[model samples]
Every structure is written in C-alpha cells, then in structure tokens.
Target: MSLATSPATAATETRETQRWAYPALLALMALAIGISASPAPLYGLYADEWHFAPITTTVVFSAYAVAALVSVLVVGSISDRFGRRRVLLTAVATLIAGLVVFMTAGGVAALLVARVLHGFAVGAIVVAGSAALLDLRPAEGAATGKRTGVAFNIGITIAVVGTAVDAQYGPSPLVAPYAALAVLTALGLVAVILMRETHRDGRAVALHIARPRVPASIAADFSFSALGVMASWSVLGVFLSLVPGIASRAAGTDNLVFGGGVVAVMAAFAGVSQLLAVRVPAKRAAITGDFGTAAALLITVAAVDAGGRWEIVAAAAILGFFFGLAFGSSLRHLGQVVPAAHRGEVMSAFYVLAYLAMAVPTVLAGWAATTWSADSVFTPFMVAVALACLLAGGLGLRVPRLTPDAVPAH
Candidate 1:
C-alpha cells in the first residue's frame, strides 16, 4: 500500500514550506530589481560606444520608467486572476530576456527596447511578488510585506556596487553584469517554481489590462497611507538622483565613491529600521515616521551646511531610518486593512502612487533646479516635503490602528 499523509500533516507541511518560501521570494525580488539597475554604471560606456546624445540618455532611462508605469497599469493586477506563482514565473522569464537583450544591444534603439522589457519585468515583479509575500505569510503581511521595501532599497544598492565594480575591473564590462544577473534570476525562477501557489481561487476570469482599483474595505485608510508613502519615497528619489552631487559639494572634493557611500549608508539604515519596525503598532509607527522624515531632512540640510563628512553619515542614517519607519508602516497599515482576495490589485494601486511620487516630484525639482540655482531650489523642496509629511501625520492621527477580519493584527 502507498503511504499517505493526513490532512493535518499536509497543512503543517504546507506551512513549513511557506516559511522557507518567504526568504526565497524576498531574494527573488531583490535580484530582479537589482538587475534593472545594472546599466547605471555602464551608461557612460554605452554613450561613448553608440555615439548617443545626453538627451538620448534621458530618453532611454525614461523609456524604462514609462514602461514600468504602463506595466503597473496593465499587468499589475494580473496575479489576482492567475496565481501569483504563474505571473511571477512569467515575470522572471521577462527579466532574463531583458538582461539578454541589454547585454547584446549595439545601439540606442536596442537599448530602449531592453529597458522597456526590464521595466515591465520590474513592475510585474512588484505586483506579483508583493502579493505572494502577503499570501505566503498571511498574518504578518504588513510587517513581512514591508520587507519588500528593504529588499528594493538594498537591491539597488547592491546593483550600484556590483555594476560599478564589474564595469571598472571585469574582463567584459558590458556583458559581465548582465550575465551574472541573468544566472541569479534563473535561480530565482527555480525558487518561484518550488513555491506553493498561494492564490487558490480557481474561478475563471477574463484576462485583460487593468486599472488599479482600491476596494471599499480600505479606501478610508489608503489616503493617509499613500501620503506617508509619497513623503518617504520622494526622499528616496531625491537622494538617489542628487545626493552624490550633494556629497561632492558639501565635501569640497570630487570623490565619486564617497558620494555613493552616503546614499548606500542611507539605504542600509532604512532596511535596518524597517526590520525593527515590527515592535511598534502600525499607526504609531507611520505617524512617527512622517514626523521623523521631516526632522531628518532638516537635520541632513544642517549637516550639509556644517561641512562635516561624518556629519553626513549621521544625517543619512537619520534620514533613512525615518524614511523606513514611514514607508514600512504605511504599507503595513494597508496590508492589515486590505481584503485577502483583493490584495493584488490594492497593492498595485499603492505602488502606482508610490512610483508616481518617487519620480514626478523629483523630476519637477530637477526642472526647477535647472532654471534656478540648485541652492535656491533646496529650500522650497525641503519645505514642500515637510508639509506633505505633516499632512500625512495629521491624517494618520484620525484613523485608529486597523485590522482586517481575515488577518487580524498580532
């Protein structure tokens, strides 16, 4: 007779399997996003080889950003219809294809195409990967899903370092980074294959591109949650885009590595802070994060004025810590409030706003900086971020800590 396991045993085994899948999913997200940034350090090399103008460089980068936004609009909720594993597997394949195209690209047009592929993959991964994270760890989706931000920030940090190193010292600068990322992502695909399908809804639904819909269940909470997120993510966009230059300016030296280190330090601190955020209630953490973000920005500006290198480090730590608090907690708030069946679409909506806040205001700041002096622009930008954070904090104060019936808070 064949051996058989009881239902209790199977359920226990399933839980055990999910415990392991969580980390694999986190690693998968990190690597997928990390691969997208591999081209950053090599942009100069590509420009030289392909004879592209500066404007073309912006166009190429914008192609990725726009495709990412479009992908979120289209495939962002695809996982809700299909299983998360299937959508994620397809996304991983797209990621590998993107890297392959990027490695082989000989001109701007090919590069643009590669970027669009990469962009779509990144957006899809966030949509499906995030829902998978929530499904795999049902009770702690807020705290667990918050790790996605940690993974995302750390992934970019790793990519910046890895790409820079390979481009500087590897035998084949253009090919090595993409090759490494492709291999790792292939491994991630394997991990995704091994993961149990979390979405058990076998109901057939017509497949098509979708706009993100916020379910009525959590609509009241989403506004404040989004405000905090926008405030925090804007910090990321600004620091990533301009802090290296800020570092050079403050230090009165052109040590490019030093500037990169400042940004890296901030991201590192943010991840750590998010990891620590589990101890606090979500509402309190998010409100505190909002206030902390405002204060951190002021502190960073003060440190810049002081012209102390170590001061910048302290400032980065403070800024990142607070940004993490706000971002992680706000997302956690949503995770606690959203219905299980609608998790995919709701997260897609949240990320759509996040992507917008991360990119649009920063673009506006850059435009303003170009027209005026960079020095003058900082003041108003700082004030604006502070005001936004204050508004989020005010809204957060009105809503008590939320918990869904499906997944009650700890």
Candidate 2:
C-alpha cells in the first residue's frame, strides 16, 4: 500500500531545500559574472597573434556589451513571466556554448560570436539570477545586497586570476582559460538545475524593449544616482576592456599574471568596499564613490605616465573602492525611491543607462587611442571622470531622499 508523507517531514524537506537554494543561486550568479570577464586578459594575446590593431580589441570587447544591451532591453523580464529555473538553466547552457566557441575561436568573427553568446547569457543571468537571490534570501537585514556584491566580486577575481595563471603557466594560454571556463559553466549548469523555482509568476506577459522612464517626483534623485553609476561604470569598462592590455604594455611585459592581477586587485577591493558600505550611511557612500573614483583616475594617469606596475595596481584598487561605493549606494537609494510594482522596470532602466555609459565612453577612448596614443586617451578621460564625480557628488548631496509610495520595497 502507498503511504502518505507526514506534514512535518514535508515542511522539513522544504526548509532544507530553501536553505540550499540561497547559496546555490549566489554561486550561480558568481560563476556567470566571473565567466563574463574571462576573455579580458586574453585580448592582448589575440591582438598580437592575429596582428590586429588596438581598435580590433575594442571591437571585440564592445561586441559583448552591445549584445548584452540588446538582451537586457528585450528579454530581461522573461524570467519574471516564466519560471526562474528554466531561464537560469538556459542562461548557463548558453554560457557553456559561448565557452566552447571561445575555446576554438580561430578569428575575430568567431570571437565576436562567442562574446555575443556570452552577452545574452549575462543579460539573462543578471536579471533572473539576481531576482532569484532576493527571493531565496531570508527575511532579515539587507543581506541579499551584500551577498550580491561579494559573490560577483569574488567570482570575477577567481575567473580573472585563474585564467591569468593558466595563461602564464599552462601549455596553451589561449585554449587553457576557455577550457577552465567550460568546466565552470558545466558546474554552474548543474547548480542551476538543482535550484528551486523562486518566481511564482508563471503567467504569460507581453515582452518588449525596456525603456527608462523617470517620474518628475524622483527625476533629480534618479539623475544624480544614474550619473554616479555612469561615472563609476565607465571607469570599470575601461579597465575591463583595455586596461589589461595597456597594463601589460606599460609594465613592458606580457606576463598574463600581471594583467590579470591588476583587474583582480580592483575587483577584490570593489567587493570589499561593497561589504563595508552596508554599515556606512547611503549619502556618505555616494560621496565617497564620486570623489574616490575621481582621485583614482588621477592616480591612473600617473601610473600610465610613469609605467610603474605597482602604481597601476594601486590605482586599480582605489578605483574599485569608489566603484563599489558609488554603484552600491546609488542602487540602495534607488531601492528607496522605486515602488515594488515598478522595481523591475526601473532597475532595468538603470542597467541600460549604466551599460551605455560604460560602452560609449570606452569606445570613444578606444578611438582616441587610435588617433593619438593610449596616454592621450587616459589624460583626457581622467579630466572627464573627475568633473563627473564633482558634479554627481555635489548634486547627490543636495537631492532629497525619495520616500517610497504605498507599495513595498521589492
């Protein structure tokens, strides 16, 4: 005879699954974002091996952002309507495919294709996986936010450092990193499969390209926060896309460890800053992000001019601190203003603005480097980031805090 399961046992099993789901999603998020940066240190090697110009490197790099932008605009909300589990699984599978293509890339065309695949995967995971984390997090303090930053930073550090080590010491640098990423993606796929479905909205909803809409009530606050994010993310985009290669050239060495270490230092500090920001007041965090990044830019200019390895490393860490403060604080403030009903839209818009800022500035810098030199690009961008910081910080202090409407904070 078939026996009925007891209610207590079922509840216990549910609790156990809930406990594991939170960390599982965190791991999945870390792995997805980490893999996104895996190709950074290898860009210089590709340029050298293929005899491509610096512009080609930017093209390959920008391709990822461009494709990610499209995915965010179009399919970002798919998981909200469908189940998060399916979307996350698809995202991991796509990441795996991207890694395979990346491993066997023979030309720029293939590389671009791989990055496009990665972009789509990143877009989906960033939206779905992040929401999943929030859903699985316990009803307590803002622990979800802290874990989000930590997971991303640590994951990126591992991917970049691991790839760099592989590139530096492995038999085949180009193939080695991608192989590692392939394994990571496979593991992420399994984790995603095991994750419980957190999103309950399985009803179909119409999908369209997401656009940013700022109500007059919160326009100033939104503008200030968006500007802060733009300034910080632009700096990050530069490091991710170009600094690895430039740091190698500046240090007069092609050691993969050197390039990867620069990024790892920045990412580690950024993560740490985010963890610390939880205790600091929101406005203070924003202030720090603004001026801190501005100061870091100055150091970056000096590091490049002097061609000192340690200086670049120092600059990267400082810049990361500012990035963490600005990005994390702005997002925290945004959470205060945006109503629960509209959180998805507003967050998506924020991401679009931030990504655009990141891509456009980096592209312009790339073109400037082509016209003049990398140093020339750095000097002018430093001025711009500093000016932006002053403006964002000044306005951020003035803008009043936005109180959420009747709706809850999602």
Candidate 3:
C-alpha cells in the first residue's frame, strides 16, 4: 500500500491529485474576489436609482463589511470542523442568493440586504477557500508553497479585474453586473461539485460558536503584519467609495467605464507587483511597498485637491502597485508565522482586520464629504493613513525575525 513499493504509481497519483486541486482552489478564490469587487463600479448607478446620497451609498457598501464581520465571528471556523468543501458550497450558495438580491434591488433597504449577503459570502469564501488550498497542497514537495502564492495572486487579480470590467461596460447598471456574477457563481459551484474534497474525516466535535484565538507565539507577528494590512485596506476603502464621486465632480467623467477603469488599473498594477514579489524577500518587499503606498496616497491627495485628472490616475496606478506588493507580502508572512492547523483561524483574523479597515474609513469619509470639500476630507485621511504606515514600518523594523523552528508547531 505504501508508495515506496511502487514509486512510479505514487508519483502519478500525486501529480493527478495536484492537477485538480490547485485549479479548483484558484477558481474559488477568483470567484470570491470577483464578487467582492462587483459592486464598486455600480455604486454611482445605485445612487441615482435609489435616490440616495454619498453617505447612503457608503452605508450600503459598509453593510457588506458588517455582514462579513459577523460571519467571521460566528462561522469562520466552521470549515475547520464541517470540512472545507461543505462550507465552500454553502458560501457559494449564499453568494448566488446575494446576487439575486442585488439584481432585484430597488430601494436602499434592498441594496443593504444584498450587500450584507455578499459580505457573508465573502467571509465564508475567505475562510473556506483558503483552507481548501492548504489542504490541497502537494503531497510531497516544496513547490506547493510557491504554487500556492501564485494561485492566491492570480485568483484575487482575476476577480478584481473581472468585476470591474463587468460592472463598467457589461449592460444595465443594476441588473447586468449582478446577473453576470450569479452565472459565475453557478459555474464555480459546478466546478466545486466536480472537484474532490480536500478535508474529509477529522471534523471537530464542538458545534458551539466561539471567538477566534491568536496564539501568543504568533500574536506579536500577526499584530505587526495586520497593522500594515489595515492601513493599506483603509486607503482602498476610501478609494472605492469616494474616488468615483471625486472623479465625477472634479474631472466631470460621468462614465461608469472611466470610473471602474481607475480601479481596474490599480488592481492590475497590484497584481503585477504581487507576481514580482516571488523574487524578493517578503519582509523587504513589504517595507518597500508600504512606503510606496504612503507616497502614492499622498500624491493622490494632492492630485484630487488640485483637480488634476491625469495625476490622480497616475497616483492610483502607483498606489495599486504598492498595495499589491503589500498584500502578497502580508499573506506570505502570515503563511510563515502560522501553522497549518491554525491557518484558517489566523487568516480569518487578518481578513476581519482588513474588512474593518475597509468599512470604517469609507463610512467616515462619506460623512466628511457631506461637511467638507473632497480635498479637505482627503487631506486628513491621507495624514492619518501615512502616520499609521510609518508606525507599522517602524514596528516592523524593530520586530525580530522568526526562524522556522521558532514558529509554533500547533
């Protein structure tokens, strides 16, 4: 029964297994990312259709983040017990339901509900899809780690770009983008059904819900990394929520494609930066990239205040590149610090921080826009984010590196 008795047969089986696992996991991640980004381009359209103000639109978006927060707190570890495939299926089903609600959205209430459901779907996907990837790692090779990194980058990039393009130019503002997502979710569900389950037997007996725990050994490491991630994501939240509004008012670019193109360009550059990070040390790349992000955000603030369209666009592109590098580095650092058993839980914590960062700043920015000019609002926001980035970078420099043996086995 052992592979040593028949090395060739074992090798063939290993390759075949990976052949299915990696692609399946990548598809799941991409679908999640796609759904997450789908709503960004349509916010302006929804504002007109729902007759809501900027604050209302931001609330609608924040509702998704709120739901994701709840999901992470309640069911984030469900896959650890129920199995990754089962939870993944449930997540996809929720996504389809969310899309349905989105396509049928009427008033702000309906939009809020749709976004909440979408957030739940994203939370579930982040936990389950990541666990599935870890479970599907190659049976006997170092290649699995590198491949997993690549898969993560590709999946998120595809999702961001796909959502941006569809929302911008697909068709009707409300119906077309969501309907397209529903189809993609369905396709992903089918793919999941065809793929083999990665985690089968070792289901935990505890059915009671509990809070996520970060082991002490990894806590300091996680904290340092999470701060950087939070700073970057906060910038992203503001960009996603208010940049379109700024573009319309300052540049008079009312087209959906133009607005979405700004985000798409940022995401594309981030994706490119992530692919490049494989050649560099994660820590070094993160520090360098974070500094770049702070610089870009400052440039963007200046451009926004000056009403320079091209400058804003260039700043966004550079910001996107740096953010991409920061994201890949953070995830890779987490992979290094956390053990496989606690991977899902740790990632859930990381994402909870990220989503909170994504939600809160936008809500505050929306409020600020009501009282102040976009430039005035962006000034303080940029100042706050820059300060946070500096703090993170300073802390990162002080934290000692953890050897593999130093990382906890559990």
Candidate 4:
C-alpha cells in the first residue's frame, strides 16, 4: 500500500490544529497587547530627549486611544464578514510596521505615526481576535470571557514591567524594547498564519465597515455595562497616561524603572482581582469596582500629599484591583445579554464608549495640567471618577441582573 496520508488523516490533523487554535489565539492576543504597552514607560525619556511639553506626552499617550476609538467605530465588525484570520493577519502586519517606526523614530511626529499605527492594529485585534476567541472557546458566556480579561491583564503587565526593566538596565532603552517586541511580534505573525479560520462561509455583508450601533433590545443593558466600562477604564486611562508623571512629581524622582513599576503594580493588582471576580456577582462586582475606584482616588490624593512611595504603591494596588473587578464584571454582564450573531458589532459599540472615556478625559487632564499645573490634574479626575461611580451604582440597580439561562448559547 502507498504510504501517502489518507484524506481522513489530513482531516484529523486539521481538526487537531483547530482544537489548539483557541489557546494559540489567546497567546497571540497576549503578545500583541503586551507589545502595544511597551512604549509607555519610555514616554518620559522621549520627552527628555526631544524636549517636548508634558502635554505633548499626554498627546502621545492619547494618540493610541483616539486612533483605536476611530478604528473600532469604523472597521470593528469587519471580521464578521471577512473572516478572522484575514483580519488578524492584517493586524499583525500593521503592528510590525508600527514597531519599525518606533525603532527608528527621531521626533514626536514619528512617534505619533507609530502610535496611530499601533492603535489601528490593536483596535482590529481587540475586536476580531476577541471574536475569534469567543468562537473557538471551549465554553460559553462569562467563563470564556474571563479568559480574555485574564489574558489582557497578563499582557499589559508584561509590557509595563518589561519596558521598565529594559529601559532601566539595557543600552538604548527606547530602541531595545521595540526591537525585542518586533521579534516577538514576528513570531506571533507566524502563529497567526497557522491558526485555523473561525468564520463560517457566508455571503459577505454589503457594507463591510460601518458605525457600530446597539440594537434596541440590548440598548438599556448596554448602557449600564458601558457606564461600568467607562468608569473603570477611565481610571485605568489615568494610570496609564498620567500616573507616571504624577508619581514622579510626587516622589521627586525621575527613575524610569520606578515609574514603569508603578504602572505594573496597578495592573498586577488588577490581574489578581480578575481571578477573584469569578466568585462575585456581576452587579456587586460592578458596584465594587466603581466605589472602590472612587475610594482609591482619595487614597491616591493622600499618597501624593504624603509623598511616600509605599503609599503611592498602596493606592495603585487598590485602584488596580477594583479596576479589574469592575471592567471584567461589566464585560461578563454584557456578554450574557448580547446575542451571538451580533457579538462583533455589539462589543465594538461597547468598546467605542470605553476607548472614548480613556482618551477624552486623559486629554482634558493633560490640558488641565498645562493650563493650570501638573498638581492640578488628578484632583479633577478624582472628582469625576467619584461622581461617575455614584452614577454607575444607581444605574446598576436599575438593570436586570444576569443569569446563565438569560442568554441561550448556540
């Protein structure tokens, strides 16, 4: 008999690849997201080297969020029609281009371009990659979605800490992180190439890209969840974009590694809280995140006034834990209500609000820092966050509570 493989063997091999694709996609998601945050710790260095304003630093940070907002609004659901593999490949290629720009960037303009490219890549990956993960998930509903949250927290933590370590000790602090990330991303590209396509064969939608809209039935539920995301992510946006400068200002030091570690501390606590969220009710979890963030803001102000590094760390840890609980639980609640067929578009709509919260408030904080003083920034955000949390809690009471049977799985 000929030793050539039979069609049945080939089909079995294909099935095995598909089975592993779920975890493979999760790994790629972590890598892609991690690389996206690598540059954050170095923004201070860029300012020092290039002599840009503190506001310019915020501009650089907000550039990614804004581009992501626009990208998600426009092409967020495109993978629903085009298939996930094609969209993911495009994301990887764009990310590589962004990394190349980062490697060679000489000015803030180049940094902006790189960040915008990075944002575009992340936007597509967040929507398409997440949808693919959901499609390939071994389980359904909140259980599967928690895996995404855990993956995200893990990725961000790596990026923040890795950049810190490389910048503090390595030669060419700015260049080295990007170079290493480029290699990782290259390997991720190969992983994407081998991944099985999750999209079913179907007629393509006439309009591949459109503004994401919430359906009428899910609108109220979406609003509550959106508020939770907005409140939670807005606090995270503060830490991601402004906390480094704020912490440095408070501590009277410019140690790059310390700043990066502060950011990592925030995410580290967040990752821990996400693990604990499994036991908490989603509504109580949302409220806890909101109220907890408001409480953290107060602690942060005390920490800043006290000028104790350990206190600052304590504040960040508190905020991070609540941020994790709030954001993840909000997402879990939404996943239970949003229909499977419209998952891409609906999640895109939710992200639009979330990213907008991330960018706009941070930009305004930056503007306030410039027009007023660096010291003036966190107080207003603190007030806004507290008020938003209060509102989220009130709204939380009005929304229908989630149960497993509320959403029928396919």
Candidate 5:
C-alpha cells in the first residue's frame, strides 16, 4: 500500500472539516460585523473624553463607514485573484490589530485610524467570508450562505447591546470590550485556518474593479426605485451614526445603555421584519415602507424636540419595520429591471449612490451641530430623511407590481 493515508480515511477527514467550516464561517462573519458595530456606543464615550465637537463625532463615525464602503468597492473582487482563505486570514489579523488600536487610542486621530482599520478589515471579512461560504455549501441545502442578512442584523444587535453594557459597567469600560472582541476575532483567524481554500487556481483569474454605472435602459427605473431604496436604507445608517447622540439628547440623559438600546431596538425589529417582509406583497410592502418611514421620521423629529425617549423607541420600531418592508423589495425591484449581463455594474452603482445619499444629511447634521446648537442638527437631518422618504413614496406608487418571482433572494 502507498500508505500515505487510506482514500476512505481522507474522505472522512475532508467531510469532517467541511462540516465544521459552515458554522465557522457563520461565526466569523457575525463576529466581524459585530466588531464594526461595537463602536457605536463608544463614540459617545469618545466625545466625552476628548471633548470633540459634533462635527468631529460625525467625522469619526463616517471614517469607518466610508472606509468600509470604499474598501468594498476596491477589494470586493480582490479575493478572485488572491483566493478566499488568504484574504480571510488577512482580514481577521487586521481586525485584531484594529482592536488593539481601539484599546490604546489616546486622541481623535488614533480613534479615526482605528475605525478606518476596523472598517477595512470588515470590508475584507465580509467579501471573503461570503465567497468562502459558497465554497463550502453542504450537500444538504438550508438557507443560502448569506441567509438574508439575518446574521448581520443579529451581529449588530448583540454587539451594540453587549458593548453598551461593557461601556456602562465594566471596570475598564473602554478596554474590556475591545479586548474581549479581539479574542473572539482571533478565533475567527483559527476558523479560516481550518477552512480549505476554494479558489486554488485563483491566480489565473482576472481582477478588475469596475466603477459603478448602469446602462441607460435601466437608469430611469433604477433612479425611481433607488429613491425608495436609498431613503429606506438611510434610516439604518442614520440610526447607527447619529441616533445615540439624538437619543441621549431626547432622553436628557447620557446613559450609554439607553442610547445603545435605541439602536438595539432598531436592529432587532429590523431583523424580525426581514423574516416577515416576504409574506407581505411586494407592492404593498414598498408602499407602506416608503410612506410609513416618512411619517415615522417626521414623528421622530417631534419626539426629539419633546424629549421623549420611549417615543424614540416607538419610532425605532416603526421605522425599522417599514425599512424592512421597503429596502428589500426595492432591491428586488432594482434587480428585476437590470439586464443579467450588467447586473453587477448596476448593483455596484446602486450601492455607491445609496452610501453617498446617506452621507448627505448626516454630514450636514454633523457640521450644523458644530455651528448651531446640538439639537439644531436634528431638524435638518430628520427633515431630510422625511423628504427623501416622501419622494420615494410618490415614485414607488408608479412602479409596476412585481410578480412573485420578481422578488430576488435578499
């Protein structure tokens, strides 16, 4: 016998590793996303410690998100050249370094650096993890690898709540959570080590990062639906970036847990709504989400003015529910309109526009906060959100009702 190992034995070993690979990727993905969100609560802490203006806070918040956004654009296809396992291992190690920076950050500059590092790591982690999951899809199919972003939502929720608690009550509030997460991310590194490389011949594959663009045939439809998509998606972005400060101001308390809880409420309800959204008709969901989000945003503006914390929570639920309704349907609507040959380019454009659209009101709010009163930023920000949602609602009314098959898997 050659006796290197029995063929049957080797097969069993591969099967065993592959079996573990799925959950490993799932855990690592969740952890990576969770790390991206952990800083939401801590941003408030950073402001208090550094006495930075609201503009600085907004800049701090945007640093990571924008970095991740650009990184996704730049490296979204990098794994096609380098292989999934190699990219994944680099991402996790980078995540660890980012956490270490967060632990030791002493000023605004360090925080920004840490956030950008974390953002790049997350971008790489998401893209690479997504590809890795496809590589190891088991013979028995359950949900597809991404699972409709349930994992992403859950990760955001858990991280917000847990890091909030750590910041609120831990002896080493700033250090402890990041320290804990660093350990968890290190486990993710180990998971990547266990995973077999999917793209062994990746070196021969072409790598080209295309700029975002849609064919003219699809541009008008994309523009209209994108109104709904961008408006609805902006709610989540606004909450993640500015809501903690808004919540603290609305509640007249700086309780880290309370502010973070508002975000948790949005994430949890949004997650549940994802499961429920499919049951509703696509047109109805889009209509309700578009108009409902506008109304809720207007109400949220009032709640902030009236200093109503619980009202903010209610608005979170309403906004989240409606967001769940509109955003997914809008993507499906956009997807159906695009030609298969150009779907990738169109979707990339869709994402880029959505990200930039979200930044508009947020960046303005941050700048306005510095120039005017802290609460003054809320007026323009909420008004902007409401107006965008209203625009979407009007356009969405004209969209043709999609057949059941028109809705893409999220």
Candidate 6:
C-alpha cells in the first residue's frame, strides 16, 4: 500500500504503539506508591523481631525520606535529557533491590539500606512518570487531561489501599509486604520494557542536570504551594510514625487492618479532594481545607488526651477530611505554576521541601515521645501545624489570583 494512501493504517499503528504506554506508566506510579507505604504496616513486626525502639523505627522511616530528598535534589531533572523510560526502568530495578533488602532484613542496617534505596526509587519514578504524563498529552478532543488527573489520583489511592490490605492480611508482616512489592516492581519493569519512550533525545545535557531555577514570577506562587505541601506531608509523616501506636493504645485496635485503614482513609480522602479541586477555585479550596484541618488537629489532640479510641477515630476522620483538601489544592497549584519544560526539576525541589517536612518533624516528634507522654508530644505538634495552616491560608488569600496567562515559569 502506498504510504499516503494508507494514512489510516499508519495512524492505527501509531496509536497501537502508544496505547500501552500511558496505562503502563500509571501502573508504575501505583506500584511505587504501594512500595513506599508497605513498610508502615510491617514496622510493628520489625520492632518486635529486631528489638528496636520507637526512635529507631522513626529513624528507619526518616532515612527513606532523607534519601528521597537527596535523590530529587541531585538528579531530579536528568530524565528530561536522558529518556524517561531509561530513568523509570532504573527506578524499578532499584525498588526491587530495596524490597529484597527488606525481605532479608536482620538488623537496623538492612532496614536503613532498604529504606534509602526505596526512597531513591520513589524519587526517580515520581519525577520521570510525571514528566512522561505531560509528554503524552492527547489531541484536543480527547479525554487526556481528565485521564491524567484520574490516573495520578488512582495510583496514589491504590498504593494506600494495597499497603493496608496486604499488611493486614498477608502471611508474614515483615516479609510479605516487601515480597509483594518485589513482584509489583518486576511487573512494572516488564511494562517499561514494552513501552515506547516519550522524552526527546539530544536536548541540552546541561539543562538536564542543572538545579531548578525558580522564575521570579512563579517563586512566590511556588512558595505558597510548597508550604502547603510541607504542612500536609508533615502531618502524613506523623500519622505514619505515631498513629498506628496511638490506635493500638487508645483505640485498642492492634490489627494491621485497622492501622492501615486509618492511614488509607486520609489518602482516599485526599484523592477525592483532588477530584473535587477540578471544580473549585484552588485558593478557596486551600483556605477552607487548611482551616478545617487546623481545627481537626486541635480536636484530635484533645481527644487523644481524653484517652478514648472512638474519639481518636472521630478526630482522625475529621483530620483526614481537611488534609485531603489541602493536599489536593496544593498539588493542583503545583501543576499550574510549573511549565512543562522544567517540571521535573521544579517538582524535585517541591518534593525536597515536602520530604524534609515529612522526615524532620517525625524525628523531632520521636525524640519528644521518648521524653514525654504521647499526648504531651502531640499537643505542641498540633499547635504548630495549626498555626502553619492559618499562615498558609492567610497568605493564599492575600496573593492575587493566578490566571492561565499569568501562570509562572519554573
């Protein structure tokens, strides 16, 4: 068939090639999220087996966040010049190795190594995958935008849910979750092998490795968004580190299912809030959500002090609702401010702030837990986070609204 006469055939071939790529990318993202959370449910098991204290557990978790922050800072934009597929493949391989380490974990050393490796894998995958999604934007009439948003949200939600389900029901708390993640990482590796590469070749190599240059236009905007990310992730870190223990003690719920459920509830709510942000103005959502979250945190602290499981659960649910809103709005704003070319680098920087918030606060809180009652430790944390929310919300209101044309260059 003549090439010009066979346009339909050529188009069909092109689409068939691209068909598996997007879905595979989404799957890889989901797998990364699952691996990140899998350790949470197993911490209790590791604590018993390794005879580690709460501070040690927090250190293990914090190590991952620290590694992730470092990776994002060092190589966040490398995928922009080197193909996204290559970067993502390496990420999957690293994750599989991390899982292996976790499976063989006999001491704190193995756990720390596993956590750091997983952190690197997550950092690389998030930067590469998000860039790939932007590259794969569809024709104007297609449902690409909505699909991208949904895929991102779903990937995160699945991770949260899978961590809870696997940890709760799996055969061995320590070994099973990591093993399952290894399987998932293998699947992701295969998917990447079969997919078409999306990023362009031969762009300036200097551009790939350079530190993110935040444009003046977007710096202020990104600052606000980054603050929100920091606050939200800090809360996430605290919940991951302490909530399980709190639930076991206050709620008398020692089951992995219950622990994971509380964590998953917050994540699921965040997913829902992201979808809702499609309809609401970003600033409005931020203000409302932040205030609500602040209030919820205060109530949660009070309830924990009261020493009742039901009250804590109620408070957690309330906290989850507002956190969902805050996370969604912040992410939406992030999508808006950074242009496509510099997205990976900007996002890397953004997450640097986020993981820092996630890691440092937990470490401090862990120290506080050792020196004081859990309730005493949480009271100050709650007050500080509430104040952060109020400041972010107030600043968001004061800033002029961003329009399509006014969007900042990263």
**Per-residue lDDT tens digits of candidate 3, residues 271-356?**
77877886777777777777777887788777777777787678778888888777677666666778777765787678778889
Off by over 4 Å in 2: 1-15, 138-141, 403-410
Q: Residue 342 error for model 4, in Å?
A: 5.5
Over the stretch 105-217, how does candidate 2's per-residue lDDT look in tens digits?
89999998998999998888877777776665436327787788789999989999999999989999999888978887788788777666776533576766677676666
Q: Each candidate's lDDT (Cα)?
A: 0.75, 0.80, 0.72, 0.78, 0.75, 0.72
Q: For each candidate, what TM-score against the reference?
A: 0.79, 0.92, 0.85, 0.90, 0.89, 0.86
Model 1, stretches more than 4 Å misplaced?
1-21, 37-65, 80-82, 101-112, 133-143, 168-176, 190-201, 208-220, 252-256, 338-346, 372-379, 398-410
**Pairwise lDDT winner, candidates 1 and 2:** 2
Candidate 2 displacement at residue 105 in angstroms: 0.6
Q: Please state the error at residue 22 of candidate 4 in Å.
A: 2.4
Ranking according to TM-score, highest score first = 2, 4, 5, 6, 3, 1
Candidate 1: the clashing residue pairs are none
Considering only N, C-alpha and C atoms within 3 Å, which residue pairs clash in candidate 5?
none
**Prediction RMSDs, each to the true structure:** 4.5, 3.3, 4.2, 3.5, 3.7, 3.9
lDDT string, candidate 6, 61-130, tens digits: 8998998777676554678667788898898999999989988888999999999998999878876786
lDDT of 2 at 343: 62
Residues 1-410 of candidate 4 have per-residue lDDT tens digits of: 13575634544455456787777777788777777677778877887899876678778878999888776765545787777889999999999999999989999999999999989898788778877776665356356567777887788888888887888889989788888888888988988898767665455655456446787777777888899889877777767767887887798887877787788888888889988987876667877787787787788888988888889888888988988887887787777777778876887788878988888777777788778866776777777887897787678778765445234423
Show how many residue pairs clash in every candidate, following the order shown. Answer: 0, 0, 0, 0, 0, 0
Best by TM-score: 2
Worst 10 residues of 6 by lDDT: 138-147
TM-score of 1: 0.79
Candidate 3 vs candidate 5: the lDDT winner is 5
